[model samples]
Target chain A: MELLNRAISGTMESSDIMVEIIPWDKDLEINLKSDVKEQYGKQIIALVKAILDENGVKKACINLKDKGALDFVISARVKTALYRAARRSQ
Target chain B: MFDNFSKKYIYSQNTRGRKTTSDFLKTLGLSFDENVNITINILDGKRIIATASAEKNLIKCIGVDENYRSKGLMNTLISEIISHQYDNNIYDLSIITKIENEKVIQSLGFETICETENIILMENNKNKFKKYLENISKNKVANEQSSAIVMNLNPITKGHMYLIEKASKESEQVYIFIVSEDKSKVPFETRVKLAKESTKFLKNVKIIEGGDYIISSKTFPTYFSKNVDEWINNYCNLDLKLFGKYIAKELNIRKRYVGKEPYCELTSFYNKKMKEILPLYNIQVTEIERLEKNQKAISASLVRKLAEEGNISQIKELVPEATYKYYISKED
Candidate 1:
């Protein structure tokens, strides 16, 4: 219930993050070897912008390896990964 | 409106202005008389990105669901919201949250102080919160003479002159403090000199340097970062503790004069705190509504930006000829 109990205070650093999402639903699977179109990257980036914009992260470079997870799952994974990455940077 | 650290990115992202559909869902809602109105959208297109709202002063709420996570949507939305509030004079803003939400908020320059069980009161500065309401009640009516005017004259300009003139007419003495800092384009001393010269006809006014304690941008960078409320409580609380006695002694000033900052959230908090604290010192707080030209509050920043673009003509209209010439010649 308590998603954040620790101090989120510290300096921010940059690095490449390859996020892998595993969906609870099996139907979400897609081509793993398909070349990701530039547009898809842009779409994912838009989603990321929404998250960061809502959250207020200015200095960060995130890399994602999507496994076609559901919306809630993707959000949790990204938030967890971002928190982890942020902790590592600190 | 980005009254937190993430405001910088919003400023950067604003330049790109991408396109998409879900972006329409980024409706920042405002409720008035129980009517809900959707404000600006944060996305470029179809994606429902992050969203933020500041109808609530102490805390502006921002929400970004999962699909929008990781791309800085929340940051952008919050930044934009904060920027909007700052532009509208809503300083001394804050965001309410539980302990777990610390990282996301702190990185954006929010300072956390314990407010209640499990609720961390993250604010920017505290000194600015000492509202002088008690003093106002005690004083009953505002005295026309001996009012104290405080300002962050980042650069004193003609519009500022108009404010000083207005105060001089109403008060017997106006104590003006020019903010001093190394990053200032025009040194504090020079600003004080210019301000003094421009208001030379007013014998009752006096100008002094705002001590490092009050004006250091390092102490409170929210003005530029758009994170004024993030640290305003801490700044105000600390300052009130530090300057409480000093302020009581120096001017014996019963009324503190401040210019209306329509765009900064912290200023509103300041007005609130001044009203709260002045009663302790038996002082009162007065706000001078801005004298505007072209519907814009004449400000030092506008002057500096205009001067940078060689737009001294308009600058002259807001400032005295001597001050206008000073800025123009400095450009040369």
Candidate 2:
């Protein structure tokens, strides 16, 4: 059981987005959750695929909490969750 | 025997000691122990041959020993068999062989795409339908405010719809990058078409083909395989070099959007790695919360499983209404 407390704050520019992933329990299993404003299906999927392609993840448990985050913020939260999930136990 | 050479021989159901998916599945690190009838081509005993026993799509794996070179034996065996099968509409054929053995295949009209450093991706060029979708990010679109969205869509699902829609709102323009590799369960073309059809109404959204250079088997190698670490590094480099800053620079688009996938460990790692790499190119990274269904992260794999089992009803809850309808229509 684990929880991720993360703040991915950023502004969108230059096709680049940054995120900070902080986890309350490093061992918590992850699940993925998402909700986008209507009409952006392809873009969202592409973004997810890009991140997955970078990480080489075929499958894992992840959770996504979305707040209508812009691309930059969206990128941030995703990076944060991934960072926590992939963090080596300290 | 020669008259029956080109004919496909299915060795009956429950054939003892035969394997169906072992070879192809092994390449992906998936395992299954079951009896599957083997498909063989017997060319008058001059050469022994094997093929994947699938009805709609046929995947052929060919192997010959060292001593049998230059005898024309292999040629006679494959040419006689595959030509007949191709004529009969077993159109999707793939031959997997060692990377170094491309010479033999090249003479047979096969083009090799590198599956790995040591593995070759060979396909018959006779009637391969090629569809080109530009990396909009790489194109000189003349718009500095445009943004791009990239996806693997291993299997497209509804939550994916939500994320894309959200990203579209923040950008004046959006480009969708689809991973083009045959290794996925859903064919790349099928996934691309799905993405296109699902988002066809978005006025500013453009569907672009993410070339195999960045995320295909030829580029990323199967990270799920034995060489996971090596594949991981390959993926990072490919993203940083090809997809990250370079592509962003190409379209003169400064903003890029991505979705959240916490269900997959590899994806999670990718989000982290991209964050480190984005700064070099002045790209920003966004990680949207993954959509949930009954408190579970939505996944394309889950949708595929349910679809395969004919449980289309369950998928609607996980995907958008339009996407679910699209999936059901195409699948049914």
Candidate 3:
């Protein structure tokens, strides 16, 4: 799926992740700002990357501002952000 | 001791579970507004030990737990907030601190520009702004009869070009300050490029970067935030005041030009505020009616929507020739 426009999902609340996806022409670029970066940063990035790969998203810029969200919350936020970027509800 | 301390950005909606955050700020005789663009809280095992809030250009309501005083927690929290602002491309930051906490913030690279008995207003990059003014003065072709127009030009459309063209015709010289904040989907570089390319024919138009001074994330974060009418009013007032006090005087701008916005409520409100505020600084405000196409307003947002829908032909109609060419080149 290709991003059609700039779409933002989620909130900055604790246990939540705010994800913003913008259309990019090059490779997938992810920038993460997390409170729990010292602990589970790598795992969170891997989860987001896996979700994007599963959706077949090739060129997009993803910005996530995390407030100690769990893996499931991170995955759900990424999926919703991508869906919104692609202008699809699912 | 520092290992247990972690700083995190807190959302305003989470206030329900974080009563202590407000209570902590209140204990220090500071009030927190709901319009804060970013709030960083230093936590010690789930207890808020220190907090800092930034609204547009002003950083205020800094409170540290009494027990954590002089432990370098305030400095650390402020550093984090400053770093966050810089990442968002806001280099110039201002803070209004109480007389007691003035030295602490001053030590963190904020110079006291104005001081009252109760509060001190300090800002970073004070010398940089002065240098910017000096540079503009040196290259300024505009005399006292000059007018200024500050625009985002998210993707310079015919509407923006029309406004610039009108301003140039009316004033001896028009200073076109492109909003430097990178809040738009169109990057600042591309926006500036399109504005310059589209307006290259206007010899009386002086294109300059607005830098972090005008309509910046520091001064107008409400423009990017969710629809909060009150926040928009508050931040817009602050930004316009800064323009009236500093920008207008330095550039000798006698008039400010703006497009009449009939669509966005926030922009209309800002225009109304400009009408109210600029007069106090002896500057007149002129609003030109927006250009139209097919009986509708020609706006950059509309052009962006067309581009998003991949309606390149429709975008070509809304934007200037230079902008259309640039987008077409990008597609290749």
Report lDDT (CA) for all predictions.
Answer: 0.51, 0.54, 0.76
Error of 2 at B243 (Å): 1.2
On residues B1-332, what C-alpha lDDT tens digit does candidate 3 reach at each position? 37888878876677753456667776765556666777888899888889887876668667788998887676566666765765565646787555687877765556776554455557864676677667667657747778999888888998988899989888898888888876687898888888888888988888888875676423343322233555555566667776787777777888999999888766788889899988988889999999999999998888888878878888987888988987788677
Q: Which ten contiguous residues of candidate 1 chain B have the minimum total lDDT? A: B29-38
Q: Give the DockQ ranking, best first.
A: 1, 3, 2
Q: Pick the candidate with the highest TM-score.
A: 3
For each candidate, what is chain B's TM-score? 0.53, 0.57, 0.75
Write candidate 3's Cα lDDT for A9-40 as tens digits: 66554466767787888898887777678788
Q: List residue ranges in candidate 3 displaced over 4 A.
A: A1-90, B1-40, B52-73, B79-109, B112-121, B216-219, B223-231
Q: What DockQ class does candidate 1 belong to?
A: incorrect
Which residue segments of model 2 deviate by more than 4 Å?
A1-90, B1-141, B216-219, B223-227, B330-332
**Any idea what lDDT model 2 has?**
0.54
Q: Is candidate 2 or candidate 3 better by lDDT?
A: 3
- Candidate 3 docking class: incorrect
Say which candidate scores most in lDDT: 3
lDDT of 2 by residue, B1-332 (tens): 23533434545464432343344335445332232223443333433332333222323433333444455444444554443454354533445455677876655446664344455556654234232223343444456676666777766677777778887888777777776645677788877877877787777777777763445322343413556665475556455545554466666555666666666666667767776776666777777888887788888878888888988888778765555776678775
Across residues B238-320, which tens digit of lDDT does each residue of candidate 1 receive?
Answer: 44433444443455566677777787666667667666766566677777788788888887788888878988786778777
Better of 1 and 2 by DockQ: 1
